[model samples]
Target: MRTSIATVCLSGTLEEKMRACAAAGFDGIEIFEQDLIVSPHSPEEIRGLAAELDLSLDLFQPFRDFEGVTEELLLENLYRAEAKFALMNRLGIDTMLVCSNVATATVDDDDVAASQLRRMGEVAAGYGIRLAYEALAWGKYVNDFEHAQRIVDLADHPNVGTCLDSFHILSRGADPAGIEKIPAEKIFFVQLADAPELSLDVLSWSRHYRVFPGEGAFDLTGFMTHLVRSGYNGPVSLEVFNDVFRQTAEERTAVDAMRSLIWLEERTSVALADHGGAPGNDGGFPAYPMELATLPAVAQPTGFNFAEVKAGDSGAVEELLFQLGLHCEGRHRTKPVQLWSAGGARVIINQQQARGLAPAVSALGLDVQDPLAAASRAVQLKAQPVSRRSQADEAVLQAVSAPDSTEIFLCEATGDGTVAWAEEFGSDGVVEGEPLITHIDHINLSQPWQHFDEAVLFYESTLSLVPRASQEVPSPMGLVRSQVMCSSDGAVRLALNIAPMGLEQPHGGADYPQHVAFACRDVVALARQARQRGLDFLPVPANYYEDLQARFRLGDDMLDVLQSLNLLYDRDEDGEFLHFYTATVGNVFFEVVERRARYDGYGAPNAPVRLASQYQRARSGRRDG
Candidate 1:
């Protein structure tokens, strides 16, 4: 039940990464060896920081290539591990990642590997440290969980156990069922990642393209479910390697990664219901709500909201959503992301990007309660203001691309503050920061072409957000440069960025407006249910994941499940994200995002590829006409 993730799972300097991890609400962190060695802060200082953050140093990882080495090298390795243990003791870290003979193994035999490993485990045990043996996908030996488990078993050392990495497990076609056979106690660590369904070299792909749990094409839910079913409840950590993620800002990356965790929780809940795995001790995560199943046919107004606009001209943007039934509410105290109300539902308008904020869309968010305080804190913390707009009063200021041209309105919700959007909106019925919007689940914004940079800065500077490790889509229907933004606190989100121009093909009645995304409890079940109601649902091609399976040779069950729903998939070391886009509404389209533990992003990697495929699918036959 204790959840954990590796600090290295995130991308940044060790301190930044760990802080981001803690801020993202992780209970534990796995320290990479190099991170500690290269840090300006001492082990004691690092330990103190973690304690201050109430975060546990779950593991001091990656004592690499330890197993199957010569006696001289083994002794040297032990000496190295002993030193790390001393630091771990300083930092209060408990476990270390021990790769079994990845690069420097002299012997290939199991006896040699297990014997060498066992001896090292005792050394670690002496330091009161635990060793988690892991298999690299391209390891010299012991390259899978089953094989690593064999080494742990043959070693006969309680101090040593197998670490289950979803990437290595699924990449080499390792079985999840085997995890159940092993004792949960012996399964020392669980690392997760997701990837596109391809037959590329493992190292290159894992290093460059690995995504979070919900953004790839792997069955992390099944793997974890088996672990859960076996009562192996432990820290299920994410270990990812995507270049884009590394290059992004620390806070933005952390939020997106954490959002994937939320998405994964939802998927695991649904998967357990269908596959009969162990039920979560925590509350269940229902899938994103795509239809009006539980949503009131007519939403009631909560009165806590704001709106935004970067108009090229007069009220063009305002007139659009207003026609969609949103009413002009009052102005925000501070910041630019505007607020609009309809019944109880909230709608935000963004026009900051309309003039030149190409990549970013400054949309309105529901009340954050202390808009003034949040804005002041952002400014004190060096969160920049929107260059174009200005504010007069002490009204709760939502951020207008505070960091990246991504605007946000902080309504008085939970945090202690003097400012609240309620007073400004003049609504008596609405409570402050009342999770009025049950779950954003998802949102899509259209971006202009080759202008992901502007979008990136807009969201980052404007909203203090960052792009998740996925893809920058270049579909003909706008440039689709998505940068998902989330609160410093964890929250669900989906920013479907689009390029300015339309796609090459005809976009006839496309309305590329901002829209909310939702996840349903069950897509197939809901699909059937909606069929009777005359809602037009898009059909998925059976052959999509077919190429995925044939190409990657990953597990089959998850592939079939995704295909049945016409779900789009992409993978990296992080995890797999399953996605499906709906046909256009006005100029808007929505994506139903379902993330497995291996995935977190709303299928960013698959966005461009899927868009390309959709274009091919939609416009393929038009040439003949």
Candidate 2:
């Protein structure tokens, strides 16, 4: 696929944006007119720079409100378009994007609009240029793409055709199946963007909330499938107008944009394969004029092998784990790391090269069917390879770095659920007791505000994990936005959270806590044993029990036991959930959960109370200090 992006999608000077795009491997870019108007370099100079960087100047956009006007206004618009045509000639671009008349359209007659477009097309043809007319979602009379296409057909000029914009079409709930009816040659250009389903006005939503594909709620795979079936082989470009993308680092945003296109191409390819890769009566899936390339296929991770924490002083973390019934199995022979385990759940405490950093959940080990293949696929999708030191005697794990700089190790899945690297730890023997925790239920990772969406696409594309709809949880500071990504069988779950506005800390300090939750058969029994071991539970407020009783109408005995143990309880149509949290040790904490009868939630209803309790405890600790 020929990938392109618009200059308006990034944050930088025009020159910087071009450089970032070229570095990110985009084949071409559509120059937004405002970017050119503000550039110190002339059109010819910009053309030279694009050539020097080995990039193509695909199109110059956004000539707007040129048609559906009176005679005198039509003449004036023609004069204005002629000037842009000369400039496009100078810039070495052959096409211009003319959006449907959103303003200054005195006449709503199709013949008038077509006549004006034909006149403009004559001017464009004189300059050896084409016009890709597009419909705006909020256009005065030409809001629908079909309406714009009808106008293009009436004009019957070789220089005039339609520009298919995914945002413009899908945002209006327009059916894309009609695209196949418009001959492929008349489809001059295509622009792609995905957005979450929002109830706001279309203009507001398109202008500010557009996200990269796979990061939003849009079904872009189906959109691309329809576009490909239309046999339009033009450059598939991105034209997003997002407030967040405009403020982030241009290089990072450009890379994220490229990754989105790569993912979209792969998804579209799979969709085609599912249709038997042949044209049929069902949909007539003809041979694609444009070939879509795919990546190395990988299955979703089977489960989490271990969660690793790094800290300067491991005493607090060690004691906390010990109190939770996880004993230190053994220390690594060559590294300052110890493995703590109880049943299938494992935690790694690494004290190596952690001189000044706060304790944090820094890495995760995932069990994949084939680690090498997974790593290869991740690298092809622009993930940075993470190198860890290991000797010949040690197991060499393939790994990659997530957008948040967390190292993700792709460990080989074992038949008996044993980790190969665990043998490297010189353990005397297994500890004697019934296992308190069975395995890891989930891990919550806090993301930086700017990279939250980027992290979502990263996990979805690289790991093949599916993202659930996001929700907001109220905290003491503000609202916390949380999204969950998990495998199909519910074996691996990652809860990604954007901290409430005022709670984010620089360098990921203890100010914002992240926790690892373990699944236990009986959380009440585990909580009782932890209390006897002097574990400091995150205290629950007295009012929480009263509210719980009111909500669930539990008997007195049940509520009393829950309150005495500082445990939280929740129930749904499926089953019940019992869980409790431990006090924060630096930035890392622990949770023990018992899920009954296929209850597959994270107890989201109790999140507000937990946040309030943690905030109150932190404030009280400050006063005591």
Measured against the true structure, the TM-scores of the candidates, in listed sequence, are: 0.56, 0.96
Task: TM-score for candidate 1, please give it.
Answer: 0.56
Most lDDT-accurate candidate: 2
* Local accuracy of candidate 2 as per-residue lDDT tens digits, 245-314: 9998999999999999998998898898797663232365457778888889999999999999999988
Model 2 RMSD, rounded to 1 decimal: 2.4
Residue 332 in candidate 1 has what lDDT?
Answer: 48
Q: In lDDT terms, how accurate is model 1?
A: 0.60
Writing each residue's lDDT as its tens digit, candidate 1 over 41-151 gives 999989889898888888877888787888898889888888887777888877888876667887888988888888888888887888889888899866887888888
Report the poorest 10 consecutive residues by lDDT, candidate 1: 291-300
Off by over 4 Å in 1: 276-444, 447-625
Q: Which candidate wins on TM-score?
A: 2
